[model samples]
Structure formats: C-alpha cells, structure tokens
Target: MATVSEVGELLIQKQQTITSAESLTAGLFASTLAEVSGISAALKGAFVTYSPEMKEALIGVPHILIQRHGVVSAQVAEAMARGAKYQTKADWAVSFTGVAGPDELEGQPAGTVFIAIIDDHDEVHIAQGHFAGNRQVVRQQSVQQALDELTNLLSKN
Candidate 1:
C-alpha cells in the first residue's frame, strides 16, 4: 500500500481534495488520510455511514438504491462517492460499502466489498472485490484498497 504521506503529497501537488463515504471500513479511510501531515489542505471531509438510514440521510443514497442493490453493492458504492463529492464539495470522492463480517449480509458472503471513486468531472470508477479474512482484516483491507484506488485514479488524472 502507498504511504498516506505519499497520497497527501500527490493531492497537494494537484490542488485537489478528497472525501470518503465509508461503511464497513467505517472512518478508517478518512483517518488514514488525516494521519498524514498537511493532508488537511486536500482532505475535504468524511462520512461514516455505517447504516442504511445514515447512508440515505447523510449522503443521499436513495432508499430505492439500497433496496434494489443492498448496502453492499457497486451501485451503493457509486452513489456514495457521488453523494460525498456533492455534500463536501470536494474535487474527488471515494466510497466503500461491503459485508465485512463473521457472517453474511443481504445473502452476500463476508468480504464482499465494493469501492467507487468520483472525480471533479463526475466521472466514476468502481471495483468489486471479494477478500478472505476475519472481520477486522476485511475492514482493514477495504480501507487499504480504497486508498490505493484513489491513489491510482489521481495518478492517472
């Protein structure tokens, strides 16, 4: 995984800001970014929507989306990224939604994760992954993946 400082430096150089809407990983993605010195300049904010209601109310993840795709789908992840960008007015946004558990959720097995990144132009990129681990490991891996995905996308931009 790239160091948080490296991600921070890249964002700073690009004059771009990022926010996260996290579920299974909670706020780990945001916390990781904030750990880097000078990240505040390009780290806009974060929303830890660990529940369906919070996702709906805070990030505008429509009830229909969650109902249609469940909380752990790529659609929810994309909605979250776009919603975070709109809510925080950041140049970039990333979102993670998944079943990180000792058990399955919405009929999906544990480690079923989806991540999405939305850029300033509203272009979105999403990835779906299945990991192998315990709950904590799954969550940690999700966070790392979210950061890595953002780093890759920003680098390409």
Candidate 2:
C-alpha cells in the first residue's frame, strides 16, 4: 500500500488533477494529500458535503439518487465521485459516504462506508467497507482506505 505522500507524488508525476467529495471523513482525504509539498499542482479543491442537500447542491449528486439508495450506498458514492470529477474537471475524483458513528443509520451499523473513485477515463470504482472502530477511528480508517484505493487505481493506470 502507498502512503498519502506517495499518492501525492504519483499524482504529480502523472500530471493528474484530483478533487474529492467527502461525507464521513469530511475533508480529511483532501487535507491528507495537501500535506505533501507541491501537492497543489495536482490537488484541486474539494467538497465537504456532509449533508444530502450539500451533496446535491455542491457536487450535483442527484436528489433522487440519494432518496432511492440512501447517502451511504455505493450508487450514491459513485454519483458523488462522478459529480466531483465533472464539477472540478479533475482527472481523478474520490468520494466518501459512510456511517461513522456510535449509532446505526438507515438500519446499517456504524462504520459502514462506501468509497468511490472516478479515474481519468471516467471509470468508477466503488468499495464497501464495514470497519470496526470508534467514531474518530472509523473516519480515519475511511480516509486511509480511500488513499489506498486511489494508490491502487493510479498504479494500474
């Protein structure tokens, strides 16, 4: 697995721009990449869409999609990724939507996460994770998992 800095370096090497639409992890995924020096060359701005309305308003996630699949579903995750990529015109877009809590959401247990990545070719990859941890831990784990997935995707390209 690649570290966050390595991922940033990879993005810079490829001259690929990245943007994110975050739910559970808020802006952590973008912030993590921002830690690398010169990351701004490939790190575009991100959307911290914690609410459904913001997801729709900011990222252009369809309201019907959210109502039908729920915010945490893979469909919504993919939509968020697609929206972010389209909105920012970035070569890559990563989205995080999850239940990182001490309580259940829409009958799903805590730590239930859906991550989606939109690659340069407009291919969408989604991952569902059932993590075991406290609220903060779950959020952190989601961010790490996102970076790991992005690394894997970039490596294959």
Candidate 3:
C-alpha cells in the first residue's frame, strides 16, 4: 500500500489539496497525512468529529441522516466525505464512521466501518470493513485501512 507521504506527494504534484472528516478513527486519517513532511501545501485541513453533533455542526452531516442510518452507516460516511470537501474547500476529501467496539451499535456488530472518499469531480467511493480486535486495535486498523484506501484512490486520480 502507498504511504500517506506518497499520497501527499501526489497531491502536491497535482496541485490539489485534501481534507478529512473522521469519527471512529478520530483524527488518525488526518494525523497520518500531517505526519508527512511538507503536507501542509497539499493537506488543507481535517475535522475530527467524534460525536454526532459535531458531525452535523462541523461537517454539515445532516442529523436526519444520522438518525435514520445511525452514526456508523455508509450513508453517513458519504455525507461526511462530501461535507468535508465543502467545509475544507479541498480538491479531495475522505470520511470515516464506524463502530470499533467490544459491543454492538444500532444492531451492527463490532468492527463495522464505512470509509468514503470524494474527489474534485464530486465522485464518491465507499468501502465497508469488518476488523477483528479490541476497541483500540479496531480503531488503529480502521485508520490504516482508510489511509490505504485514500492512497489507492489518490494514486488512481
């Protein structure tokens, strides 16, 4: 898988910026990008919306969507990606929302995750994942998966 630094380099080469809206992984997605040197030139910003209210207020994810689909659904993930793109005004954006738990959420089992990516053209791609581990491990795996997915998508673009 491509590293976050490699993704940053590609974005810089394309003269584009990227942003992230995170939930279960917190700011891990953004944190990984920020770790790359000179990423500020291509990484516009990131929003760590760990709560439903912040997701709605900060990233413009609709409360209704969250209510209907719950926080860890594909719909919420897609909305978050689009919302992050708008909020950051970046050429690309990614969002992650999921249940990384030792328990279930909204009838979904633990380790259920949804990762979404939105490009400049408004095209959105989503991937569903189920990881095995404790809460921390699930969250860490989610971040790695999200970064890998974003790297792959950016590479394609």
Candidate 4:
C-alpha cells in the first residue's frame, strides 16, 4: 500500500489537486495529507460532514440516497467523494463513511467503513472494509486505507 507521503509526492509531480470528505475518520484523512510537507500546493480543501445532514447540505449528498443506503454505505461514500470533487474542483477527491464506535449505527456493526475515490474524470471507485478493533483503531485503519486507495489511484494515472 502507498503511504500518504507517497500520494502527496505523486500529486505534486502531476500538478494535480485533491480534496476530502470525511465522516468516520473525521479530518484524519485531510490532516494526514497536510502532514506531508509541500502538500499545500496540491490539497485544495476538505470537509468533515460528520452529520448526516451536512453530508447533504455541505457535501451535496442526496437525502434520499442516504436514507436508502444509510450513511455508512458505499453509495454514501461515493456521493461524498463526488460532492467534495464538485465543491473543490480538485483533480481527485476521497471520501470516508462508516461506523467506528462502541455501538452499532443504523443496525450496522462498528468498524464498517466505505471508502470512495472520485478522479478528475468524475469516475467513482468504492471499497468496503470491516475492521475489528476499538473506535480509534477503526478510524486509524480507515484513514490509512483511504490514503492507500488514493495512492493506488494516482499511480494508475
């Protein structure tokens, strides 16, 4: 898997940009990107749509879509990435949505996460993961996986 720094380096080399929409991992995805030196040139912005409403209001996710697939599902993850892409006009956007908790959410078990990537072309790719750990560990894993996905996607381009 590619590290966040590796992703940042590639973005810089390509002269592209990125944005993030986060839920389960909060700002970890964006924060991690920020940790990479010289990333400011590539990271357009990021949003933390922790609330279901914000996913719609701030990120432009459709209410009916979330209602149908639940907030933690891949559908919502894709929508979140698309929204971030639309808002930031970045060359790439990543999104995270999941249940990272001591309790279930919308009947889904904890550690259930969906990660999505929307490339400049607006094509969407999604991945689902079920981690086993406490809330912090689940979130950490989500952030790492999200970055790795972005790295792989960038490598492809």
Give the total clashing residue pairs for model 1.
0
Put down candidate 2 lDDT per residue, 32-102, tens digits, no spaces: 88999999999889999999999999988999998898998999999898999988999999999999989
- Once fitted onto the true fold, the runs of candidate 3 whose alpha carbons sit more than 4 angstroms away are none
Cα lDDT of model 3 by residue, 1-157, tens digit? 5677778788888889998999988888788778888888988889999999999999899999999999989999999999989987999988889988888989989999999988878888898999999988888788778778777777777
Which is better, 3 or 4, measured by TM-score? 4
What's the best-to-worst order under TM-score? 2, 4, 1, 3
Highest lDDT among the candidates is held by which one? Answer: 2
Tell me which residue pairs clash in candidate 1.
none
Q: For candidate 1, what is the lDDT?
A: 0.89
lDDT of 4 by residue, 116-135 (tens): 99987788889899999999
Residue 32's lDDT in candidate 3:
76
lDDT of each: 0.89, 0.92, 0.87, 0.91
Best by TM-score: 2
Q: Which residue pairs clash in candidate 4?
A: none
User: Least lDDT summed over 10 consecutive residues: which range in candidate 1?
Assistant: 145-154
Q: TM-score of each candidate?
A: 0.96, 0.98, 0.94, 0.97
How many residue pairs in model 4 have overlapping backbones?
0
